[model samples]
Target chain A: MAENLQDKAHELAKALRESDEFQALQALHEEVEEDDVASRMLSNFRKVQLDLQDKQMQGEQPTEEEISQAQKQFEMVQQHDVISRLMEEEQRMSTVIGDMNKIITEPLESLYGTPEDEQNQ
Target chain B: MAENLQDKAHELAKALRESDEFQALQALHEEVEEDDVASRMLSNFRKVQLDLQDKQMQGEQPTEEEISQAQKQFEMVQQHDVISRLMEEEQRMSTVIGDMNKIITEPLESLYGTPEDEQNQ
Candidate 1:
């Protein structure tokens, strides 16, 4: 029985790999990697973002200057076509993976129950 | 690029499905389904659980009687070995799936930045 279930999971994974969303994201990722300017900009943007997140987690609010700096960095990244496209593709792939996770956990959800979505009602 | 990412995702999914955790969960799910008494108990438990969740979502707390009834139902199911095993397997599977989700989303996490874990500091 375990073997069968594993087989099914493998099939599902295969299907995801064949999905267009994943393919597009992969392509964009490679493109970003190849462009030094875009790659550096993305790295810098991520660094600023992580720093802000770290501060917040420590119960420290980012200073106004820090927030402004992060915002400026984000805008700069968005201005680049390759960077923006990669970002969009990343979001799409994330959504696809998210949906898959939900499906995989459906049985557990039925058994353990989760919070209901009031807004969906 | 997108194609390549999709391929990687597919591979990851396949690996998850083939994992021992997934297999054990699948076997338990089958066992529960085949046992009439266990199956009924599980179905009833899920129904009551969903109802309680729905009430909460509607901004209504379950009555004391309803809470007691739900608790009793849970206790009854837990007494069954098959059901208990299924529940444990489900938890294990959920954890496996949760980890996969985290890994798949790592790139996005790096790009967009998520809240840092203060406990890890």
Candidate 2:
């Protein structure tokens, strides 16, 4: 189950980030089937580790006003990174869904006809 | 098949919007279970109806300048409406997914352990 995999995934992510294994895996990710469990898991873990690092860095505490200001700056950068990444993902998904919606709805339009006519007829 | 439903869906969308039925259905939609096929379908249809209306409104023929300006305004409003609505939906879905993911990953963390220790130990 994923319960066990969670730790393993984190470990794998950390190892991959620091280790040459990730570089090797990256090549495989491109050439090998993306659907391969190892490839997918590795890819997902890589993103997870990066996000976790950003989150950890963003949560740092500062003692002095200058440090606090620097911490805030760092937090903003991390926050922006996370939010922008998510927004980009959402935009991509929406675009894909929108395209699918268009394709799927095209035939529907022909079958159903325009709304104006539906009321009169 | 969806092929047939597509046409029926458009026709139904028009009817619901024009008829008093939509008002009645709107009331029903609130009381009825959201997961109900009819309610969900109606909800989805309403959205489609509104988007189509906006698109149609924006496409009206304009004279050399004024008409084009009006059309452009209409188009921006329509585009923003559609994009913003979709973005809102995406944000909502992401929030839900993020929550679920946190819940799901909690157990996984316990099972795996920290990445740093995984490689060393």
- Which pairs clash in model 2? A7-B112, A111-B7, A112-B7
User: In candidate 1, which residue ranges exceed 4 Å CA deviation?
Assistant: A1-121, B117-121
| Residue B53 lDDT, candidate 2, scale 0-100 | 63
For candidate 2, write residues A77-120 as lDDT tens digits: 34543333433443553453344234433433543366776788
TM-score of chain B of each: 0.88, 0.29
Error of 2 at A116 (Å): 8.7
How does residue B44 of candidate 1 score in lDDT?
95
For each candidate, what's the DockQ?
A: 0.09, 0.03
Give lDDT tens digits, candidate 2, residues B1-121.
1233234333333432433323333344344344465445444544555655676576643345744555554454335434334334435534533442343333324333557656787
Top TM-score model = 1
- Model 1 scores a TM of 0.55
- Show where candidate 2 strays beyond 4 Å: A1-79, A114-121, B1-121
Candidate 1 chain A — worst ten consecutive residues by lDDT sum? A1-10
